[model samples]
Target: MVFLKTLAYITLVLPLVVYLILNKRNNNKPSRVIFYYLVYSIVHEILVYYLTNFTDNISDSNAIPLLYAIFTIIEFFFLGYYIYDSLKNKLFKKVLLLCSIIFLITALINLFFIISSGVNNQLIDTIPVSTSAILLIIFSILYLFEEIQAPKIGFIYSNPKFWIIVGIMIYFTGTFFFFLLFSDLSGKDQYNYWIINLICIILKNIFFTISFFLPLENENSNEFDSSFGINHYNTIK
Candidate 1:
C-alpha cells in the first residue's frame, strides 16, 4: 500500500507538473493559482511525510501548525481563483454567484460566533478547510461551463475531464469529512481517529489514481485532433 501510495502520488502529480512546465514553455494559458497549489502540495507532502515519523508528537509539533497554515492559504487562493474563472464564463456565472453568497454568509456567521466567544482558534481553523472543500466541488462543476461554449475544444465532458471531475469531487468530500471528523480528535475515541485516518488514506489514494491518467487521455485526444485537423480547437486544459 505504501508503494501504491507513492505510485498514486506520481500518477496524480506528474501530469500536473508536466502541464505547468509545458504551458510555461509554450506560453499557453497556465493558471498561477494551480501553480501555487502545486508548490503547496509539494511542500506539504514533504513536511507531512517527515512529520508522520513523529506520530506521537504530531499534536504539539510545529508541523501541524505549518501544514494547517499552508493548506488554509491554498484554500483561500483556490476559492478566489475558482470564483474568478466561474464568473468569467457566462454559463457558470450564476452558480458562482450563488456559491459566493453562501460562502460569505457562512463566513460572517463563523466570524460572529468567534467574536462572541473569546476567539476559538480550533473552530476558526475549521472554517477555511470546510469552506474550501465545498467550493472545490462547485469549482469542479463550474469547470464544465467552458464546454458549453466550445464542446470540441476543451476538456468539458470528455472522458478524462469527466473522470477528473469525479476524482476531484471524491477527494474534496473525503478531505472535508476527515477535517470535520478529526479536527478535535483529542476528545474522540481512539477507534474513531484510526477509522477516519484509514478511510481518508484510502480515499486519497483512490483520488490520486483517478487523477493520474486524466492528463494522458486528454493529451492523446489533443494529439489526435492535431494530426487530423489544424483548427481542432486545442485548449482543453
Candidate 2:
C-alpha cells in the first residue's frame, strides 16, 4: 500500500509539472482548471496522508472527503468547458448542451439527496463522487461521437478519438473505485481509500496531460470563454 501510495503521488504531480513546463516553453499558460485541480490534488494528498495516520479521529476528518467533492465540482466545470469548446457541429453542439443540462440536473438531484440524508457536512464529498461519475459517463458519450464521426475539431483524440476515450475511461474508472472505497458502507480500510484516491489522482492527471498535448482548433474560438479569456502568454505580454 505504501508503495502504491508513493507511485500514485508521483503519477499525479509529474504530469502537472510536465504540463506547466511544456506550456511555459511554448509561451502558453496553464488553464485555471488545471491550476485548481493541481492545487486540490496536493491538498487532498496531504489530507489523506494525515488521515492514514490519524485513525482515532477518522469521523472528524469527514471534511477531507468533502473537500474531494468540492474539487469534483471544479473538475466538472473544467471538463465541461473543454468539451463545449472541442465540439464543432451544430448537432453535436445541441448534444453538448443537453449533456450539460443533464449534468446540472443530476448535480441538483445529488445535492437534494445529500441534504435530505442530512449529510450536510459531507455535502461536498457526496457532490464530487456523484458528479465525477456522471461527468465520466457524459464524456464517454462525447468521445463516442468523436470516434464515430472521425472529425478533426482539434482534440487530442482527433485522429482516432480513442486516446481521449482511453483517458476518460481511466479517469472514470478511477473515480468510481475511489467512490466505492470511500462510501459510508464500503467497509474498506483507510489504506484502501488512499489507494483509490491515488488511482484517481493519477488517472485524472493523465487525462488532463493528454488533453493539454492534444491539438486544439480555434483555441481562441470560444465566445463563452470570456470568463477566462486571454491565453497566459497574452496576459504576461
Candidate 3:
C-alpha cells in the first residue's frame, strides 16, 4: 500500500514538473490553469498526509474533508472554464457556466450549513464531488462528439486537449461510484478501494504529461474550421 501510494504521488508530481519545464517557452491560459490545479492537488495531498499522520482527534483531523470540499469547488471552476474555452458552442458554454455556479453554491451550502457546525466539518460531502464527476463526464462525452461531428483535423489523437478530456472522462467515470461510497466505507473497504482511485490518478497524470509534451499551437490558429471548433477561437481576444 505504501509503495502504491508513493507511486501515485510520483505520478501526480511528474506531470506538473514536465508542464513547468515545457511551458517556459510558451504558455496559455488553459495550460496555466491546469498547472495551478496540479500544484493545488499536490499541496492538498501533502497536507492530508501530514494531518492524518500527526493528528489524533477526528474533529481536529477533519482537514481532509474540509480541504476536499474547498478543492472540489475550485477544481470545478477551473475545469469548467477550460472546457468552456475549448468548445465553440455558446449554449454549451452557458450550460457549463451555469452548472459551475450552481455547483459552487451547493458546495458552499454544504460547507457552511450541511456539514458539522464547528471547525471540524467532518462530513466528506460527496454530493459536490460526485456532481462534478458526473457533469465533467457528460461534458467530456459531448466534447468527443463535437470533435467527431466537426470536420477532421490532424489526427484527433494528436490533439492535447483531446487527451486531457479523455483523461478526465476516464478518471471521473471510474471514480463516480467510489466518491458516492467514500464517506460510508469502512477502513478495510477504504484501503481496498483506494487502489482504484490511485490507478485513476496515475492514468490522469499520464494523460496530462502527454498533453504538456504535445507541440504548442497558436490559440487563434485557423487549423480547422467548424462552428464548434474551440481551438480556432481566441477567448483571450
Candidate 4:
C-alpha cells in the first residue's frame, strides 16, 4: 500500500511539472486550466494526507469531505467547459452545456443540503461525482467522434487534445462504477477499492504528461477550421 501510494504521488507530481514546463513554452487555455487542476489536486492531496496523519480527532477530519466536495464542483465546471470549447458540433455542444448546468445544480444541492446530514459528504455526494464522470465519458466519446470525422492532420496521436480526451476516457471509465458504488461500500471495502482509483489516476496523469510533451499545433489554422467548422483557438480565447 505504501509503495502504491508513493507511485500515485509520483504520477500526480510528474504531470504537474510537465505541464508547468510546457506552459512556459506556450500556454493555451485548455493546458492552463489543466495545469491549475493539477496544482489544486496536489494541494488537496497534501492537505488530506497531513490532516489525516496529524489529527487525532475525527471531527477535524471532516475537512476531507468538505474539500473534496468543493474540488469536485470546481473540477467538473472547468473540465466540462474545456470539452465544450473543444467541440464543434452545435447539438452536442448544447447537450454538453445543458448537462453541465444540471450537474452543477445537483452538486450545489448535494453540497448545501445533503452533505451536512451525512457523516461524510464525499460519500453522500457520490451522485455529483458519478454524474461528472458520466458526462465526461460522453464528452470524450463526442471528441473522438469529431476527431474521426475530421480530416487527418499528420498523426492523430500527435494531437494534444486527442491525448487529453483519451486520458479523460480512461480515468472516468475506470472510476465510473467505483464512484457509483462508493456510498454503499463498507469502510474496509472502500479502503481496498481505493487502490483501483489510485491506479486509474496514475494512468490519467501519465497520459496528461504525454500530451504536454506533444508538439503544440495551431488550433486556429485553416486545416483545423475547415475540419471542425470553428476556430477553436478563438473560441477558447
Candidate 5:
C-alpha cells in the first residue's frame, strides 16, 4: 500500500512536469483538460492521504466520503468533457451531455443525503464513482469501435486520443470493483484494497503523461484524429 501510494504520487506529478516542459506547445482541448484533471487529482489525493493518516477524527466521520463524492463529480465532468471532445457524432455528444447533467443532479442529491444522514457506516456515495466508471467504460468501448471502423487512421497506439481514453478505461476498471465491494469489506480490508486503486490510477497518469510526449501529427505521418477528421492541429479548441 505504501509502495502504491508513492507510485501514485510520482505518476501524478510526472504529467505535470511533462506539461510544463511542453509548455502548451502541444496543448489540445483534450490534453488541456487532462492536464487540469491531473492537477486536481494531485490536490485531492494529497488531502485524502493526509486526512486518512494524520487525523483520527476523520476515521469515523463522513469526511472521506464527502470529500470523495465531490471529487467524483469534478472528475466526471473532466472525463465527460474529454469524451465530448473525442467523439464525432453529434447525437452521441448531445446524449453524453444530457447524461452528464443528469449525473450531476443525481450526485448532488447523493451528497445531500450523505450530509444529512449522520451515518458512520463505511457506506459511501459510491454510486457516483461506480456510475462514472460504467458510463465512461461503455462510451470508451464505443470510441474504440469507432476507431476500428475508420479506414484511414493510423495505428491506435499512435493516436493521442486513444491514449487518453485508454487511461480512463484503466483507472475505472482497476477501481470499479473495489468501490462496488467497499461497503461489504472490513475497514482494514478497504485500506488494503486502496492499493489496487492507487496502482491503476498510477498507470492512468502515466498513459496520460505519455499522450503529451508522443510525436505530434506532421505531414509525413498517417495519424488521423477522429475529432478533427484530418490533421487539424491547433484548431481543436
Candidate 6:
C-alpha cells in the first residue's frame, strides 16, 4: 500500500518533468493546458493530504470531500476542453458542448445541494465523479473515432493527441466502476481496493508523459501530428 502510494506520486510528477524538458528543447506546443492540469493535480493532492491530516480549524470530516467536489469540476473542464479542441466535426462539437453544460449543472448541484449541505451522509459524493467518468469516456472514444476515420499523420500513434486520448480512455474505463461503487464499499474493502485507482493513475500519467515527448505538430488550434524522431510537421505539396 505504501509503495503504491509512493509510486502514484512519482507517476504524477513525471509528466510535468517531461513537459518542462520538452519545452526547453523547443519540442512543445505554445499552449500548456496539459501542464496546467498537471500542476493542478499535484496541488490538489497536497491540499487533500494536508487538510485530511494537519488542518484543525476546519472540520476534518468534510475537508477532503469538499476539495474533491470542487476540484472535480475543474478536472472535467480541462480534459473536456482538450477533447473539444482536438475535435473538428461540427455535430460532434455541438454534442460535446451540450453534454458539458449538462454535466456542469449536475456537478454543481451535487456539490452545493448534497455534499456541502450536509444533507447527505456519505463521506464522498459519487455523482460528480461517476458522471464525469462516463462523459469523459464517451468523448474520448469519440475523439478516437474522429482521429481514425480521417487521420492526419502517416502513422496514427505518431500523434500526441492519440496518446492523450488513450490515457483518458484507459483511466476512466479502469476506474469507472470503482468510483461508482465507492459510496457503497466497506472501509476494509475500500482500503484494499484503492490500489486499483492508483494503478490506473500510474498508467494514465505514463501515457501522458509519452504524449509530452511527442509534441503535437499543431497545438496552434490546428490539430496535426509529428512522426517519431521528428518534431515538426512535414507538408507534401
CA-lDDT, candidates in order? 0.54, 0.57, 0.79, 0.80, 0.81, 0.81
Winner on TM-score between 2 and 6 is 6
What's the number of clashes in each of the models? Answer: 0, 1, 0, 0, 0, 0
Q: For residues 171-215, what per-residue lDDT tens digits would candidate 6 score against the true structure?
A: 889988888999899988888888988999999999898888885
lDDT of 4 by residue, 1-237 (tens): 778889989999887788767766437887877778788888888987887788777453456677678888888877787788889999989999999888888888877764565455344358888888999999989988987887755667878878878888899899888888998998789889988888888899999889888766765552544524555545665
All-Cα superposition RMSD per candidate: 8.2, 10.2, 6.1, 6.2, 6.3, 6.0
TM-score, one value per model: 0.54, 0.63, 0.86, 0.87, 0.86, 0.86
- In model 1, which regions exceed 4 Å deviation? 20-26, 51-58, 79-83, 90-125, 145-155, 158-167, 184-237
Better of 2 and 6 by lDDT: 6
Give the per-residue lDDT digits (tens) of candidate 2, residues 128-199. 565566666676676566645642335444422244446556666665755654546444454456666567
**Candidate structures ordered by TM-score, highest first:** 4, 3, 5, 6, 2, 1
Better of 1 and 3 by lDDT: 3
The TM-score of predicted model 5 comes to 0.86
TM-score of 2: 0.63
Location of the lowest summed lDDT over 10 successive residues in candidate 3: 114-123
Which of the two, 1 or 2, has more lDDT? 2
lDDT per residue for candidate 1 within 1-237, as digits (tens), equals: 455556655644665655555553323222344445556666776777777674775544444554554555555556456345534476467666676667766665655554455423352256656776788777776675554544355444344345445555776676676666556657545334445444544554444334333343343344335533655455442
Query: Global lDDT for candidate 5?
Result: 0.81
| Order by lDDT, highest first | 5, 6, 4, 3, 2, 1
Tens-digit per-residue lDDT, 24-79, candidate 3: 63287777877888898998888877777877885554567787888888888777
Q: What range of 10 consecutive residues in model 2 has the weakest lDDT sum?
A: 24-33
**Residue 122 lDDT (model 2):** 40
Question: To one decimal, what is the Cα RMSD in angstroms of model 5 from the true structure?
Answer: 6.3
Shift of residue 170 alpha carbon in model 5, Å: 1.3
